[model samples]
Target: MKAVNEQEIRASFANCSKGEAKRLALPRDLAEQPWDDLDFLGWRDPGAPDRGYLVTERGGEVVGVALRLSARQRGHLHRGMCSLCLTTHPGSGVSLMTARRAGQAGRDSNSVGVYVCTDLACPLYVRGKKLPDLGGRLEETLTVEEQIDRTRAKLSAFLDKVLA
Candidate 1:
């Protein structure tokens, strides 16, 4: 990730209002982030936890969206998956991460949720770059703790960008 100017970051958020952009706590140094492994950047505003956000550089521009927590106990199997990484969390793999919308659009933007991973693996880490296929069962190749750490790493990077 390279450093991004405020103007550039703001422009990426064309769908948002100027006031919303001004209020967001975006990262100042992109170089400090681990861009190689991140699926997307995610963070919660320190001043307003209810005003979390995510930013992904699509094409050549940064696209950010304010987010909110939507914790719901979804039944296993058919629940939605994370918007970034496509992993399933089974009985515990679901959180409805709704996005903050424009003045009037928010009232109807229910579909723009964060769709958190059931394990909530942070997007910055999580071994999104896979190693060679292991020669054994999935459980034998990677321990649960290892799996969580990878996810957390990704999440931390995104959080840093947003909270910075």
Candidate 2:
């Protein structure tokens, strides 16, 4: 994925109002991020842990979405899996991240949710650049490239739901 600037990131949001996107916090270290290794840029708000953001390229256009963590607290005893990267994490390593639907559906208070890594680092986990909190990532028959593609597909599907 190509590195994007703050203006592109803010303007790419499809599911939130422009004012909201303008006000939301962006990652401070955009220049330091591993852009070459990312399929999408995702981060939780430091000032508001429950708020998160994702930005990526879709059909040659940069697109973004705002996410909110579910109200339910996760237990730290059992293992959980990220729906996007298929990485197995122990306890609170995964979360139910949700996004409001775009346009009228969002106005109607509709949203979609997916189980993802709590820190939203799917690309790193898929590439072995990052590891789960408790156990190591699950071994898979697919190559790293294949896993990355799979993760992108899953995320695209989720985005499709939101954009629809």
Candidate 3:
């Protein structure tokens, strides 16, 4: 992934109005983010725990999506896996996040949901920069590059669904 500025990030949003995107919270540590290691920029809003966001490149152009975390609760003993990276977490580490479909469908209240790491750090987890609290780390025969490719593919598919 490439390093992006605030204006680029704000303009990339597809599911929300421009004004809303402008008002959405961006990471305070954006300047310090490890852009080279990132597949996408994702974060949960500090002011609104249920709200999350993701920004990534799609076919050379940036695309952004706003996500809402499901209200359902999970037990700490129950293990959940991120659909994108396959990292397993004991509880709140994984969440059902839904993004409003882009355009008119979004106005109609349509949304697409997927189970993802609650922290929205799938790339970090896949690359071993971050570890899931419960599973330690996933063991796989695929190389780091292969894992990164796979994770990005999953994300693309999810974005495709949202855009559809």
What are the per-residue Cα lDDT tens digits for candidate 3 across 1-164? 99999999999999999999989999999999999999999999999999999999999999999999999979888889899998999878899999999999999999999999999999999889987775755679999999999999999999999999
Per-model TM-score on C-alpha atoms? 0.53, 0.97, 0.97
Q: Flag regions of model 1 displaced more than 4 Å.
A: 1-3, 27-31, 71-83, 86-94, 100-111, 117-122, 128-164
* lDDT tens readout by residue for model 1, 1-164: 44455676666663367787887887654456666555565555667644555666655667776666665565555545454444545544446665545445554543354566533334432464332121111343576556655555654444343333
lDDT of model 3 at position 50: 94
Query: Residue-wise lDDT of candidate 2 within 50-104, one digit each (tens)?
Result: 9999999999999999999987876778888899998888887888999999999
After TM-score superposition, the amount by which residue 5's alpha carbon in candidate 1 deviates from its true location, in angstroms, is 3.6
Alpha-carbon deviation at 17 in model 1, angstroms:
0.7
Give Cα distance to truth, residue 81, candidate 2, Å: 0.3
**lDDT score of residue 60 within candidate 2:** 100
Better candidate by lDDT, 1 or 2: 2
| Residue range with the least summed lDDT across 10 consecutive positions in model 2 | 131-140
* Alpha carbon deviation, residue 84, candidate 1 (Å): 3.0
Displacement of residue 32 (Cα, Å) in model 3 is: 0.2
lDDT on C-alpha atoms for all candidate structures: 0.53, 0.93, 0.93
